[model samples]
Target: MVNKLPLSGETVIFTSTKKSEEPYELVRQLGGNPVSYPLIRTEERVSVNDDERMMQTRNYDWLIFTSQSAVAAFHHKLKRFKMDVQDYELRVAAVGEKTAHALERIGFRVDFIPDVFSADVFVRQFNPEGESLRALFIKGNLAGTLISTELSLSVDEWTVYETLPEVSSAARIVELVKDTTSVTVLFASPSAVTVFTEHVAPKIGWAGYTIGAIGHITKRALHRMGAPVHVMPETYTLPELVQTLAGSKGRN
Candidate 1:
């Protein structure tokens, strides 16, 4: 028999620019009304107008991918730049499991994966030694500085993808919250939190709402925007955040 989740009747909003399916389904399985609103728009950076220098060579020691979006954007660039995925002879290091999975989907093998998903932790344990250990990271405009300064290897990061505010989804988010009472909004990244403020404008009407942040940076953004964090989970995973919020609601 299937178990019932405790979050029945609760409405939780998710912010993911890439139209995530798994996380949203997980939320629905838990009996929560999960709504996804993409906050950032992404596009491939490689183009006819792109710098010839940037597209010149794919030789690198390691290819680091931080998010699944980076993976998607990188592959798109590969198609446009006429890059041979096999031409780049380098090890793969991914910060998150999802990112690694995305690469795997494209038949790429990742050699270095850490237990923790955070960029800071990945840098600490990364052992990018050897002559072919120099690294190149395919990342977004809002990537953290950890990539450019890999503690173990010579690292360089290129903004292969850029993120912009998704105004339409943002506006729809505001509309959802306007009708729903006491909604719990989940911010997955700093960009999501940053865009939320502008997209929603006067806020998500936290008058009867709660906020949930996926990470520390997102927490800071919500507080900066005057949203009270009713629940900040110990972990940043989607399941953990949902469980934490549901548990907190029951406790109160």
Candidate 2:
């Protein structure tokens, strides 16, 4: 039906392997097009070596989780330590509602959750006024500087997850961009946008496509790569992105 394929002529690529049908449906409703092209691939960077050490202590003042993946990976590592949920006594703080929800499902009480779900916001909420609190940050290896700069607290970071490039997908994307007359690439993260543009720059050359970023950070990444980001949402969320595209249906 015409209603289901509102995005019939438009071909947009999603960055994650995970499928977000809401955006596709929204694009279809607006007579645009949508496609899936995962840029970054996720893999657990956890190991038994780190788990063996973490299990020996309960001195951390807080356990901070940045992403849902970090929470999941951290829990997965805990399973190898042969420990129950009672092993951790520290206060828990999470970056986003979704991350907090993941921790809550595992029966850990989250003590602090910031209003906004950005690195800068999370940093601002952390206390510099308190005594030196030993905080443990569970995040990706390539995390932003907020954790170190904001807290001024004694902190340790572990790379529970690593975001690597999908080399094959990147090539396919380049081919897709080169073959198509026009395309619109949706970028949700600065990292994804950076890697995407860097690899496709020489080949695609932006002849028939425009870049779309989720927010200012991602938009900035696009700029650093010398790629112009045309569509940016006022608020950052998957649903917001869908609505933004739905409002402007004429893009090819």
Candidate 3:
């Protein structure tokens, strides 16, 4: 006899960007009804000195990426200027495995990935000797300054993408949250949590559903807004999140 899927007959909601197909597919494979209700969208940010900034990447010893979106936006800038990734001899540091994979896809060798995927752990564990290092942080506009502030090295930040709330999905999100049955809502970023709090929480309130955050920062964000986090994986990756949720189904 075949074993039943872990998430059989459950509904899983994805609240990040619509481009997140991996986790969505994982949930589907686990026999959950996956829904793509993106609560945040990202757009590449352009500046008058973008060309010059792209050229200046060679000055840094390391390129730090915290998210796949940052890596994608950086790659886009490189292609726009007809620049090759090999032209810069900068080493790479990524906060998560997915971010490192994104860097590798663009021909970058990731030199560092902290044991934990959060920025606070990254800062604590990275460069423990307090060695002077020059790094450029490729991030979205909404990213916090924890890395720049806490790291012992000189860090320059490049805003390659801007995350905006996906207001259009509010109606759909309202409908989903209204149903309390076997529904698990997953949040990958604090920004997504903020969007949900501002737009959806007032309408439906944080009841009749299971909430999951991708990392401690996002979990903290949910707590700040008076929402309980039902599931959070030890490793802050999309695949891990989905797997953890699937495993939790048995416990619930």
TM-scores for candidates 1 onward, in order: 0.85, 0.81, 0.95
lDDT (tens digit, per residue) of candidate 2 on 1-252: 224443456677777555336777666666666778788777888565876656743678888897777877778776766676687887898877667888998878999887666778778776734687788888886788778657778888767889888756788888877777657788877767756766766677755776677767777887887778777767666556666654454333
Ranking by lDDT: 3, 1, 2
**Model 1 / residue 171 / CA error / Å:** 3.0
Residue-pair clash count for candidate 3: 0
For model 1, how does the per-residue alpha-carbon lDDT over 1-252 read when each residue is reduced to its tens digit? Answer: 223675677888887663446666766776788877778778766656554634643667678888888888777766766776777666788876678888998768999887667787787888766764667877888888876875667777778777877877877878888888657788778787778777685655555677888766677878888777777767566767787887776665
Candidate with maximal lDDT: 3
Local distance difference test, each candidate: 0.74, 0.73, 0.88
| lDDT winner between candidates 1 and 2 | 1
Against the true structure, whose TM-score is highest? Answer: 3
Task: State each model's C-alpha RMSD to the native.
Answer: 3.0, 3.5, 1.8
Quote the positional error of residue 133 for candidate 1 in Å. Answer: 3.0
* Model 1: number of backbone collisions: 0
The backbone clash count of each candidate, in order, is 0, 6, 0
Which window of ten consecutive residues has the lowest lDDT sum in model 2? 1-10
Name the lDDT value of residue 107 in candidate 3. Answer: 92
State the lDDT of candidate 3 residue by residue for 158-195, as single tens digits. 99999998988877888876764788889999999988
